[model samples]
Target: MDQTTLTRPEAETTTAAKPVILTGDRTTGPLHIGHYAGSLKNRLALQDTHTQFLLLADTQALTDNAHDIGKVRRNVLEVACDYLAVGIDPAKTTICLQSHLPALAELSMLYLNFVTVARLERNPTIKDEIRARGFGRDIPAGFLCYPAAQAADITAFKATVVPVGEDQAPLIEQCNEIARRVNAAAGREVLPEAQALIPEAGRLPGIDGRAKMSKSGGNAIPLSASEDEISRAVRAMFTDPEHLRVEQPGRVEGNVVFAYLDAFDAAKEDVAELKDHYRRGGLGDTVLKRRLEDILQALLAPIRARRAEVASDPAQVHRIISEGTQAAREVTEATKREVMDALGLFRL
Candidate 1:
């Protein structure tokens, strides 16, 4: 596979046309600030200019949460609520349910043939996740094959752009490889290759200073968290332990508080000054935590209120999802037909 196909050319910009963007969250839990800094903020910005589809990926969630089906089922609404709460307008972005789109599943099954098991195992994202989850040889087949499933999701919509974290860029590469293989076999370009759009902030670390902030890790501050919850999470944030005394110099390089501030605090100059002060001594963790707490409280207040308002009517949320899923079904089914025709499948 040519590596050049993985990204759009510099000459082709979004200004040329409204590109299709496919992005979503697994129905694992409520979204957090990590999600916001990583992708949600980009989604909010892209919805107006691009044809964006926000998938409530309940099916993908099952790859890891299969043991607790209830958790995956319930968080579908929770994730959708978070999307709307964060200002993803249902009018601009098509917010669809993954399970409801049978075409995506069919496409996934078809795409698996175009990719090799060895290649799947070699995927950097998959390798890292398997290690993190300690799946060992007991790795679930579905979990191992998620890159193909993700490829199906991306190509089913003919998406040109996919917003993902820096760590997940390999998945996009795998997706394009599958697309190229399928197109090669069909003797034409059946699926459009996609480019991964990595956010500037990259991945946000957990409050405990772990590499990634995740709900299961109990280190993520959910967007819907109450003011008290936000305050407590900030207070417990991991910082330089050696800086026990206010007069001791602190290291900001690996401090989770500084990481969050970098991701959230709009005032870059002030944060830089604070970092310098901490490094030179005289800055305390308490003061830093207080600053982060204030920023988070202000940021989440409106999101929490909007989430409460939208969640108050379950039927309304369901209707919004159903409508978007119906729309997605039409789009994905058409692509499935195109792919089938490209492969000369019988049209009985």
Candidate 2:
């Protein structure tokens, strides 16, 4: 791939004062604490201040889940419920279904010309997913070109800020590359380059002490998990393996329990005391798990309750998604028209 394609267009050198923020997740499963720490909380904060467009990326989910449409369909509502339960006010945040925007596909097709196959293959984020999924040679074409589609998604909204985790920084870079190339080719700034806003909390470790929590890995505590489920997940969380006994000194490093505490527990002094005790050979996993469970239950009680309330009225949930998707479609249409005009391509 030519590196020049990734450079920012000379005509578009400055950013918008109040940037439009776009961030979302694949609708493969219900969201979890990882989602909360990584992007969901940021979305909540940005919704009131910036023009936010949250996407339920059903189409992207299909790249890996084409064989399981039912799972994806079920999760669309589950994820939406999780969003509402987590206080993403739909009035402030436009939550849209990715598949509803046909223009995104058109844009992706056009953007593909700007990005090379070699460049897409070199994307660290995509490579990580490919390895994680064990796709190897059997990787789907759609999965390979996901970045192009993502660029389209971001540029369709003219997103200036994309809140993401550290791992997704490359994805933002790829999106900007497409934006730069598209605008430069058009001889005008047709798309705005997006910057990644990585969260301070970064990746939350899974209950199994994995580098990152994932729904498919069965290591995630879903945002909508019941109190009992949360408790069970907490109890099973991976702690210091060498500290087999309560009296044995434990290692705090790579301990999933401690990781969760650092991420969620507000009792800084208490958590520090507990960690000290564990390090010095006193605290047990049971005690630490209990503390985590209490803190998590308290934090998630209201979210779970709200999710229950939202899930009760399926029609209302559908209505919200329908309205949001329609509104998003209009935005996508306008963006598509501009892109076509810039390319001097006739719209059918």
Candidate 3:
């Protein structure tokens, strides 16, 4: 066992060192407000205190984007920019590209022995992904095996804390199971179990009132969306479908505009009053949409400006990724050696 990796979460002790947090995004597209509300904001707040590692999961992205490798490659930088634009300081957070660490692949191969095809199929996260992709019976082997791969990512950094949304809690649970199994097999604890730290109100509904906001859904507002783009998205947002006229009382429940307002609008009393007006009638959808647009514009303006500033210098962004990747590679290499030694692999 690595005594250093076995540190417990401090109990009633302010002087204890901050917990290490590992979280990140897949580089399939630019992140959206859903990402911000879910984990990105937590990253910004935790980066200054915790040992944070953020992964641009291009290799995981390949589980789905094998045919369109270009799209995943193109958005890696865009995702990094979004991270910086939203106040994830490179100086504080180590942002690494997943494919840059061959050790992760090696670790995944070793971790696979601890997991099973039946267990991977039962993973709610993978099941959801399979359904969302409409794969039915044609699921790719890589896609099916990704949970083990993800376990490798978590264990490689010896990450004790994984910040994720509720939907991904199962992934953390799976990692814990793998950790316990591997340690038992080796007759000692080599890997530490990771705990899931879910943020408050982590999941946000899409503009279309869908269950999730994602690039494939075409209902997400990019964190770097322009004012015009934001306005258009807000205008097109889903509202009470039964309320056809301004005089018709609307339903606040499940309205996308109200959901966004509740998440981002700081004027809680005003929003509550608006909800009252909306439900009582005489409030137009246009008025509600316009209010959301104004709030969104105010919220996104600085992020957009920062993204533009960062995007203007592509080389600097690459350097940050390159440097972080190198740092992460060193860490994973050490982890790989530990695993290899425990499994009795030849030193040569």
Candidate 4:
């Protein structure tokens, strides 16, 4: 916890009076287009209006990826590269490493006492994730207690705003519950409750038509995917199977291609017209896929190029992370001290 701040032009500093926002990605893998459509796009806008802190949740990634610590370690930089490539300016948003923040871990340990294992098990977000991972009776302790950990991450920064998917609303609720209990114990608001800011775009479906686009599921198109990779993913996308002929009417309700179009295509009217044509028949899946592929390639080419350029300078990336982590350390430490003092912990 060295307090190291990278020297920057005075003009680059953001106002400290803005509302604090905490949002981040688990460093399990590189971010994908789904991330862009869902949270990243909102983050880009919020950084200008709020004090944003982006955490590389390597500590949380260990809940499932403990077996492959190397993967988590390696992707910390990869995720950071993706963030920069996607236009998350470090000056506007503090991008910090989660494992580097000792205060977060300390707060998590303290907050755990305020919540019960039954309540944690009842968390919809945690339950769904457990089912999806098939953890059953073998759920990892870290994974089970992640709601508390998330509460720590949120309250440690006193983040009033957190951008997350709709499915993650319960976790925010759980975090606020912990915050309230701690405040009640302290006889004052030692930690601020957070609100979940779910994106309008919601969750993006995977190419295979899964409800979620995830790297572990092997259905995601990474932001750094090559043109050929994007094309291949689009081509393999799940569409209406019964709409075999171009002349036959098709269904767009569950079509993954249309889902992606809704998420990424800027021309809403054009997408609507395509959807109409798709539903009425005379439009082929290949045509829709081709259009989606073109849009994706155009969208990702610049990001891929930028990611490559940024990644080429590892020292600069490391410095950005180090500086951000240092700044975040100071914030978390101050909050931890406040909580400890409120709880009448021995300081000497």
Give the winner by TM-score.
4
- How high is the lDDT of residue 239 in model 1? 97
For candidate 2, which ten residues in a row score worst on lDDT?
A: 5-14
For candidate 3, the clash count comes to 0
Model 2 C-alpha lDDT per residue in residues 1-348, reported as the tens digit of each score: 122322222212112345688888999999998998888878888876887778999999999999998998999999988988898877667778998889999999999999999999999999999998999899999999999999999999888899887789999999998898899899999998999988887799889998889877788999888888998898788887788998999999999999888888888898899888899997789888888898899889999888888888777777777877777888788999999999788757
Error of 4 at 271 (Å): 1.8
**Would you list the clashing residue pairs of candidate 1?**
none
Estimate the TM-score for candidate 3: 0.92
Query: lDDT by residue for model 3 over 76-142, one digit each (tens)?
Result: 9999999988987776678889999999999999988999899999999899989989999999899
Candidate 4: TM-score? 0.95
Minimum summed lDDT over a 10-residue window in model 4 is located at 1-10
User: Backbone collision count in every prediction?
Assistant: 0, 0, 0, 0
Candidate 4 C-alpha lDDT tens digits along 155-261: 99899999887778999999999999999999998888899998777789989988999878899999999988998888889999898889999999889999999
Worst 10 residues of 3 by lDDT: 5-14
Estimate, for each residue in 1-348, the C-alpha lDDT of model 1 and write its tens digit: 122322223223222357899988899999998999999998888987898888999999899889999999999889988988898877677888999999999999999999999999999889989998999899999999999999999999899999877888999999999999999989999899999999888899998999999877789999999999998898889999788899999999999999999999999999999999999999999999999999999999999998898788777778778878877888899999999999888888
Candidate 2 vs candidate 4: the lDDT winner is 4
Give model 2's TM-score versus the native structure. Answer: 0.92
Kindly indicate the candidate among 1 and 4 with the higher TM-score. 4
